[model samples]
Target: MASKDLAMGMTFLTQTVTGILANVVLLFHYFSLCFTGYRLRPTDLIAEHLTIANTVIMLSKGVSQTVQAFGVKYFSQITRCTVLLYVYRVARGVSVSTTCLLSVFQTVKISPMSSRWKQLKAKLPKHIGLSVFLCWSLNMLVNCIFPFYSINKYSSKNTTKIKYFRYCSSGFPDKITEALYAAFVLFPEVSCSGIMIWSSSSMIFILHRHKQQVQHIRRTNVSHKSSPESRATQSVLVLVCSFVCFYTLSSCFYASVVNFSIPSWWLLNTSALISTCFPAVSPFVLMSCNSTASRLWFKFSGFVRRR
Candidate 1:
């Protein structure tokens, strides 16, 4: 028992340290998100939405990580755990919604002239933001039903402490409800991915044709070269790739959880980590792909002109 307790303590400590680091990096990324519109363009709400999504995710992760790092032996009040779970739910909903919106944004940005995907290119962010707000409100209502229900105090002192973290859950209200909800959520996600892939593929095709034409007209003084635009396109591609993998894995894992393939306790400790990983991964991917970020530091320091 003592050895098992020590192992849990070590795991919590390691996880917490990493979680804190993720949040720190996310903070810098959040600034980039803000720069997306406020400095870049306030009307450019996609960057704002992405930043908001990442912020919520990291904060949710911090809440879970801090509590667990208190060590397994430290007992927490019902309010604390309830708060943690709620934070996780909100963060996750924002992350998924924001990512979905971003994927559609990419498709719109790169769609061929004749593609129907271009039609939604303009409305992507607004629709996504509205959808995010809607989903958030729904999640809050659903989660509240559980946390406030049957949240009973135990012990002579009325401790109201979770022996193993109780009061509200990640569990669905019922098996049928969980399955139906999973299908509903999963459908849009799969459809979005498909559309993104098709749109990106068409864009790549167009780019290739343009490249060939430019090569043929190289000495005619009419050829155009891709400069920063190519870099921007590649950066968007990287973001798309990141989500493809992250979303695929996360969706599969959630399906397993809903289907009862994963044990409940394991899901409890580990699921929160996935929230940190998704938004945390995207900004870094964007930084690596974006030449714009390279000029950001120098611009801020007055050492170089803003690109």
Candidate 2:
């Protein structure tokens, strides 16, 4: 392999390995909490699903890209390409949906407890599982078209409709079918992004107002630290901002690829790398921001040090 290809392969390999490990640790922590008789918060439940989706993206997209970058003929078959493409698309959609859900849930969580808010707050936790289930089911249904359109890279050379990727290719449909598919895919993504922006803005406003109200009291009380809600809000804000930044860049790269009649190999690699950034970084974000995860990490580190 060329030096550039080697570097890109290593980058992808590092990202995939790191992301998978971080997500595994987080997932195991959550499951351990459950087994230890700890009741998981609703946000924890949503986060677990996000971790799973991120892991899937790492495996299906990140690992494949890495293998292909290193000059391996992975996903050389039509069936393998189809299955991986389907799974990656579904997982990518679910990641967006779950992140939007997390932001909205946190916004409602920290809102002032009015009667309307009270009812929502009371009912929201009960439905978190259902919400996550719907995210998975809807994404799966929407991305079912992938299997029909996916082709191996070698097969793409015979067809005029093929859109090139690093390891696999996507068969573009007729104009009407393409428009319909784009609509189904873009609508949910746009809606989720809008929700995330609105929720993040609401959270910022709420946090600012609370800070102002408590400023004098905090100054007077030496021991007063930030509240749990405040910490959680800050974490969600960071999560939302990071997700939006990475997702937007990824979308732009993806758009560039789609716009070109034949996208360059570097463009393909750049798009794939940008697409995996959020997934690779998000677990560490959660681990650092979440007190429970932080504590668990510290304990684990200390235990390792003793050994």
Q: Which of the numbered candidates is closest to the native, going by highest TM-score? A: 2
What would the per-residue lDDT of candidate 1 be over residues 127-226, giving only the tens digit for each residue? 6556656656765664554343224333323222222333232434455755575565456558667765765575577568757766756767664556
What candidate 1 gets wrong by more than 4 Å, as runs, is: 1-44, 69-81, 112-174, 184-195, 198-203, 217-226, 257-272, 289-307
Which lDDT values do the candidates have, in the order given?
Answer: 0.54, 0.84
Output candidate 1 Cα RMSD.
Answer: 7.0
Please give each candidate's TM-score. Answer: 0.63, 0.92
What is the total number of backbone clashes in candidate 2? 0
Model 2 per-residue lDDT tens digits across residues 27-104:
888889899999988999999999999999988888888888888785556645777778899999999999999999
Off by over 4 Å in 2: 152-160, 295-307
**Against the hidden true structure, what lDDT does model 1 obtain?**
0.54
Could you tally the backbone clashes for each prediction? 1, 0
